[model samples]
Target: MEHDTSLITTIAAGFGLALILGFIAERLKIPALVGYLLAGIAMGPSTPGFVADVDIASQLSEIGVMLLMFGVGLHFSLDDLLAVKRIALPGAVVQMGLATGLGMLIASWWGWDFGTGLVFGLSLSCASTVVLLKALESRGILETMNGRIAVGWLVVEDLATVLILVLLPSFAGILGGTVAPTEETVPLWRTIGQTLLEVSAFIALMLIGGRRILPWLLWQVASIGSRELFTLSVIAAAISVAYSAAALFNVSFALGAFFAGMVMRESEFSHRAAQESLPLRDAFSVLFFVSVGMLFDPQILMEKPMHVLSVVAIIIVGKSIAAMGLVLTFRYPLNTALVVAASLAQIGEFSFILAGLGMSLGLLSSEGMDLVLAGALISIALNPFVFAAVNPIINWVLQRSELARRLEHREDPFAELPLTTERKYLEGQVVLVGYGRVGRRIARELDKRKIPYVVAEQNRELVEDLRKKGVAAVSGNAADPAVLIQAHIAGAAMLVIATPETLNVRQIAEIARTLNSDIEIVLRTHSEDESQFLQKEKIGTVFFGEEELAKGMTNHILQRFAP
Candidate 1:
């Protein structure tokens, strides 16, 4: 009981440490994951006093993976998935094979047995999906061709990793002679057949049962309108499925998580699940990376520094080469190919699992673990630099030849930047707040006259919907100073605040006055009292939506009377 309490306490403490260190890492322009890893190192067995419960950390890491994969599946639209099919499928398999071959050769040179070498190579083949996704998001390239290819390639890598996770333990048991692949009653082929049958049944249940049942269950809960219950149910489904896959079918939990996500992808509840699971997923992911970092012993630098560096080189440099080859083969532009390659050049979560399993199975000692751990750390640390260099490299390549010119043209089909940046505000134009009924008619008139104007909207969904209709609108909180800055309030010739909410309109008018004391502010309110308050703030124009509708009706009556 004492030991259990201590374990719980350590895990709780480690969680706090991870969060604090993550902020520091962000401030320093380093990956928050690296900070989390460093925090884990500081709290691991090698460090002085603060040790985290390794078992608990491992379990949480599993949950992190499930949620992370689920989110990935949710975001992966049909278009994005179809875009990278050519490269991601064949390229992932070929690249992993090449990496494994290289790793096996290196291991043999370093005097490791074939079994150990195979595990080592398999570990080297994975790329960190979480890290790459975050990097792409930060660069605003998550929807780019390169980003699509990187994600799809990781998806392929993830499937291969799941296979490795299943095979490794079984192989270890067989090679160690603890369990024979073939027993008297069950021949090796028969055992394999049974295993396949089990896997098939499990998959059928998840795909068929999961697809039909999971969505219905979630929808039922959603109908109750209990946010807490909805969030809990999503978590329970993800965790339960992951556990069931591992416990019953002897497959990796990661595979179960992937399937769970794929099945849920068919549901309307996917977006809600993603939003709810993000916080938990991020917490566990930090812990997972930190634990990986803790495994790196700096002492190895003294003895086999060259070997460790070589592994890192292969991971960073070799992976890049393979990725570039695959990207180019798929007919992507040279710029996109380089970005895709550079983005996926780091060792990932599966590497930690592989190394840990190998250590437990007596395939690798502490020294070998240190080398793999060091390689993971060094590769991860350099990943940001590699990503940052991609744009510069692409620019340089673009200036080289005829091929470069074509690639550059492909990179930016619309070479012209938006007119929003030309001046502080969209001058001598009517700024529409909402693109609804009244605002739409006003915009049509403005368009007919060739007037320059900008639309600011607080509703992201609505903004995206309008964008599809070719309306120029920005999305954010109207009350935010940054939003006002982006919309360029200073030089605006006129402002149109049209919304159902009068309070919001008044607040927006106040913000407009704060930004530009000289610019005309318009308040589209439902109440006369609201208009008076807006007018008091030096707003030159005020249009009550209710009054405007009433006047239009009155004018129609007057015209009928004259006739």
Candidate 2:
């Protein structure tokens, strides 16, 4: 009797529900992504009591996707992208091809049209830039080789998505006119050519115009120093370019947003734009995930369960292989390669956009839509678990074969390359690899003896603190050649590799030995087995702390007995 709930009201209700679920997800130590999906399922058309307006939700999600992509572009400088070209370009192309091919094969097995299958394949080929990055960052792996490669690969995937968005509609339109429901003939080739031309021209214009005018516009805006005005202008530019892409050039709004971000990245206002837009981006991005979740009809998984499961399996295997192969080929550690591959084994937000486009163009059926939605939700929900398994899987692989043996090999062709042009410092000094309890104690003892020493510690903060106390410290991994050089290992009287007693310690010790053949090497370990391992390397000294602890305990017991 109060009033009818309009679509807007329904969307608002769905959004509120999503926010609550997201909060719940965070509290439960689960990925917030799961919460967003659960929120969608609760308010979806298939659910009772709170049916959402799917159309409105989808539109809002479009904005969310753009903002998210814009953020990615803002953080990723062109220089960084070019630097990782060895992995970013080839890895992405291979990964996409493999995933898409697997998708097509799976879809074909299910008897779907070849074109529909191809579209579905293409959808599965993409790894979500947002999801993978968030997972890696949360796990504190963003600076590792795995993290770097995954980010580069995702960037490649994003570029592919832009091109696909540019051409998808025309391709579908052509296929549509060629098939049934074409009462009038349409020139497919010319239409496609014109669409491609328009898109290419727009890209060229943005590249040139963005490089020239955007910086100037941003500078002009900055000169005013009005926060409100600057924020308004940035949003206006984002929306204006997005609107133009959709209205004038017939491009996807997301593409325009990406281009706008790329332009904004070059401006001085980049950091401010990123900071200001985050609140809005988060609000919309949450809605997007929630909306995506709402599209999940779990019942469809029961109906077309095999098809969904098959596609998901293909995505995991295909994407993993593509990522791992590329990362390893580019000479990242094997452990890092495995982590990178596993992290990207799921489908992403862009996949949904492709499916949505397919649906609009009649290339996807209701069943196909449901299948895609279910796969996306399941993959996103399970991403944390997949990521968590990376280390364990790597450990297992390390025990299996020679391939794993070489994973930690630091004998790369550039191992001997020195970092600085200046002659080595720390001549006749000792190089200490770690600064842990044993390592640090040893360094102090050496200092008391007046033996000059350099500390090479991976903990950057600890290295800084040491330097402030008038210590010579090199900030980086002991296993890295650059760190050794920075500490002047070649000019040292001795090398002490005191890292944790892990498998990689052997590699570090070997590297130190290779760098200075005449320099004496000492190792500190907690176990007799570790002592034996170091002995095999003919280390000058091996201190087994646990054995000493055991002997002290025995002495105390005997003294008590004699007393």
Candidate 3:
């Protein structure tokens, strides 16, 4: 009369523990991911409680990895990557090299062979995409220049890790590791060529064919008027492409799903697709973090305390210093350098994959894997703190060091607009903040009406383009007093903020009001809470996107009924 309850028990334990711990973590002002990992630890074999099937958990985690990468691809902007390539590409490479070197040195000192050291080093080189995205999104900066740079940097690291994963087995002999007899032995150049060809073919196929086919498939599903079917199609597409990539091209699920999302993003229904698939993506992402926790053996913390410490130092300190130095050397602002540094100060899924692979190849020992897990656990738990410390630490350093102050205050000529001789353009004009999707539309309307307005945009390139078009534009955060002054906010008739930056909207409004008390202010926000708060405070004329959309739809329906 008894039923096989293994799957149900595993699901119940995972979801139940994760929900409790995630809520606690949120209450404690830590990221819910930390809680999810803790839940995994609690239910893991490493702990005393119920042990979920490690094999099942691992498989679930693969789905999590695929979905997480797919979500990242949905938001991936080629323009953003190109915007930060001058720094992100080289900076990521250099930072990873430095971090890897630190790991290798530590491993060598521990008497591990060259192969173990190399594997250990490689595992520590990349940051967790999930952690980075969560941090950036919480801060409402995922669309900012700093966020774009961090994302681009992670993308570079991901690509590098993928290449390493592909090449590792071929080098097992030289690395003092044993490869499976079934493993194909090819010349190094041939392996490299083959890998590149496969990747190129996949990319080409996705970009050319998948872009058209996937969207068409989604459209067909939607036309059937079944929400369940649409969601199923999106999930099926993600998993199917991921499986095919691994089965046919020898590509990782992460890369395959990323390409799928990227191609899907080209469709007009991208937003709808993202919204529909978000719940599944988030659930799997949680499972991914939980599975990571299951691999962690707390015994390593006590047994090899110094080794764990050394790894954590490399992840948090060594990597951060390397990234900050590279960013500053590139003449980016101190804020940007600190943000990028904080973002890279943790490792996650890729580290686990590398460590497992290394162990399977007899390159990394169980002890080494434990150490990597220990470091990942600690570093991830501390990542939110690291991000929280960025501004305060920068302020503290600037306060004590004259050089630091100078660096913070230094302005990049390329990022700032030159003052114009004509004062008429500034006086009695509307000051528009941001130059993104919404701002662009607003600017177009303003331009067509021949309204005198100046744009204050953070994207220097966008500002440059505006200037080229004979429009008055200033390049800087509108929240900054100097930028507002440059934009002539004091004399502006109206101020419009066309970005969903709820974090700084209040400050920007305050600064604008102080500069021109009579200036009419309009602000856009995606959050109902923010809109209500702004309105309650009399901050400005706040527009909630969803509310406006609802109102527009209601009005259209009412008109139809009236006719």
Q: How high is each candidate's TM-score? A: 0.69, 0.74, 0.88
Q: What is the C-alpha local distance difference test score of each model? A: 0.72, 0.75, 0.85
Clashes of each: 1, 1, 0
| Shift of residue 3 alpha carbon in model 1, Å | 8.4
Q: After superposition, how far is residue 367 of candidate 3 from its true place, in Å?
A: 2.0
Error of 2 at 395 (Å): 2.1
Q: Candidate 1: where is the Cα deviation over 4 Å?
A: 1-4, 70-79, 173-187, 360-364, 400-563
Higher-scoring candidate on TM-score, 1 or 3: 3
Candidate 3: tens digits of C-alpha lDDT, residues 218-243: 88888899998988888899999999
Give residue 302's error in model 3 in angstroms: 1.7
How high is the lDDT of residue 359 in model 3?
83
Model 3: per-residue Cα lDDT at residue 423: 72
Q: Which is superior by TM-score, 2 or 3?
A: 3
